[model samples]
Target: MGLLVGLVLTVIGFFLSVLAFVLWIWMLIDCLKNEPSVGNDKIIWALVIIFLNGIGALIYYLVRRPERIKQTGQ
Candidate 1:
């Protein structure tokens, strides 16, 4: 019984990790698809989220996305 319970918990943990990865990928793709301009801060944040994982996603949401960056009038 204990062994079965341990296996079940391990499976659940694996699924949760996979879910988090999927969510991160989804967020990265969504951010990339947005026509938010090249060199925009949000894009950087998105890339950070994509490559850096959890902390980057948190920063993207809490710090970057809220303050939209404008293209430098080059």
Candidate 2:
């Protein structure tokens, strides 16, 4: 029925939200610990993740992370 469908949707939404949060936290930690602290790279990424939330985290993961890992071998 309608109520059952709503409950299912709600559960899926909740899991998605939790996944996003976990991703954000993981990215933030990775940036802090592994990112080069040579200049402001670590600080900048931290700010981006904090201010932009999940989107910023995803950006860091998809864009910068691979480059950093490849470039630095870290």
Candidate 3:
């Protein structure tokens, strides 16, 4: 029973790690792609995401991401 529990925990940990990694990469790319006008500085945000890891990505998503605009052909 103990062995089975350990294996399950390990698998869960692996998936969480992968999710964090993917989030980090996605945020890094998004930061780079953002226009200069979107926020203070793209380079700074990129560095923050790189250094702070998942937490930084969460912060950027919550604070810096631009609002979506719907465009209808004028």
| Candidate number achieving the greatest lDDT relative to the actual structure | 2
lDDT of 3 at 15: 100
Looking at model 1, the pairs that clash are none
Please give, for residues 1-74, the per-residue lDDT of candidate 1 as tens digits.
99999999999999988887776776676566653666675567666997789666666656555554343221
Report RMSD (Å) for each prediction in the order shown: 5.1, 0.6, 4.0
Candidate 2 regions with alpha-carbon error over 4 angstroms: none
Error of 2 at 28 (Å): 0.3
lDDT of each: 0.67, 0.96, 0.77
Q: Each model's TM-score, in the order given?
A: 0.64, 0.97, 0.79
Q: Candidate 3 — which residues are off by over 4 angstroms?
A: 37-40, 66-74
lDDT tens readout by residue for model 2, 1-74: 99999999999999999999999999999999999989998999999999999999999999999999999998
lDDT tens digits by residue: candidate 3, 1-74? 99999999999999999999898898888777753544567778888999999999888777777432112111
Model 1 — which ten-residue stretch has the worst lDDT? 65-74
Model 1: how far is 40 from its true place, Å? Answer: 2.7
Candidates 2 and 3 compared: the better one by TM-score is 2
Ranking by lDDT: 2, 3, 1
